[model samples]
Target: MSRRIKGLVEFEDDNGAVVRYLRHPHGGGLVSPAAHAHEGAWLAETSYVEAGAVVHDGARVGPGSWVDVDVVVGARAVVGSNVHLGAGTRVGSGARVGTGARVGERVSIEPRATVTADQVVPDGATVGGSGTGRRSGYGRAA
Candidate 1:
C-alpha cells in the first residue's frame, strides 16, 4: 500500500519493496528519495525526477519535464517545460534545453550546450561535447 507523509509518498513497489518519494512543493512533481535534488534546485510541479536522478544546485526543471531514472542534471542546467529526458541522459552543467525538447536516452548534453526549443535529439547523440557543439542531422523541429 502507498502512504503519504508530509508530501512524501511511500510507494509499495512491485518487487515488494517500499520506496520513498518526495513531492515538489511548487509543482507537485515526484522526486525519488534516492535522487538528489539540491536545495537550490527548482522543479516545476509537473515534473518527475525518478530514482538515481541527480538535480544539482541551481538547476531548473520546468513543468511537464520528466527526468527518468539515472538521469543527471548538472548544476545550473535548465530543462525547459514539456521536456523529456530519457533514462541515463546526462545534462552537463550550464546546459540549456528549450521548451518542448525531447532528448533521447543516453544522450550527453555537454556543459554550456544550448538546445533550441522544440528540438528532437536522437538517441545516443552527443551535443556540445568538445569537438563540435551539435552533431549533424539534428536541428529544430519543422
Candidate 2:
C-alpha cells in the first residue's frame, strides 16, 4: 500500500531527540504533532490523541475516541466503528476493541486486554485480561 504523509511536525522524544510526527491521509482527528498513525487507520476529525500514541493499520477510531498519552492501538483493532469512545479514554497496546463497542469516558484498557468483538464497556471502567474470560477490573488499582 502506498502511504503519504498528510500531517507533519517536529517534536522531542522521551530521549530528548528531535523526531518527526507523521499522520496518514486517513486520519482526521486531533492527533498530536508527536503522534503517528498508519495509512489505513481512520481517526475521526473530532478525536484527540496525545504524544506517543499510535493507531495501526486498518484500525478505525470513531469521532470521539480519546487516545491518551503513550497509548498504542494494535493492528486491525476496530475501535468505535459504529459507537463512539468517550472522551479521555485510553487503549493499551495489543488490546483489541471490537466494532460498536461503547467505551465510556476515562476508561482504561490495560495492555493485552481484549474488549472482545463488539463488547460494551461502561464509563470509568477498567478492563484487563488474557482475552479468554472477558475479565474486567483485573489490573486496576482501587
Best by TM-score: 1
Which ten contiguous residues of candidate 1 have the minimum total lDDT? 133-142
lDDT winner: 1
lDDT of residue 43 for candidate 2: 81
Q: What is the lDDT of residue 14 in candidate 2?
A: 79
Residue range 1-142, candidate 1, lDDT tens digits: 9888899888788999987789865456679888888878899976889989999988999999999989999998899999999999999988888899999988888887888888989888777734334423443322
Model 1 C-alpha lDDT versus the unseen true structure: 0.84
lDDT of 2 by residue, 9-88 (tens): 45566787765444446766666777777777888765666777777876767765666666667665556545555555
Candidate 1 lDDT score at position 111: 85
Which residue segments of model 2 deviate by more than 4 Å?
A: 1-24, 81-137
For each candidate in turn, the TM-score is 0.79, 0.51
Candidate 2 weakest lDDT stretch, 10 residues:
132-141
Give the Å error, residue 104, model 2: 10
Please report the TM-score between candidate 2 and the true structure.
0.51
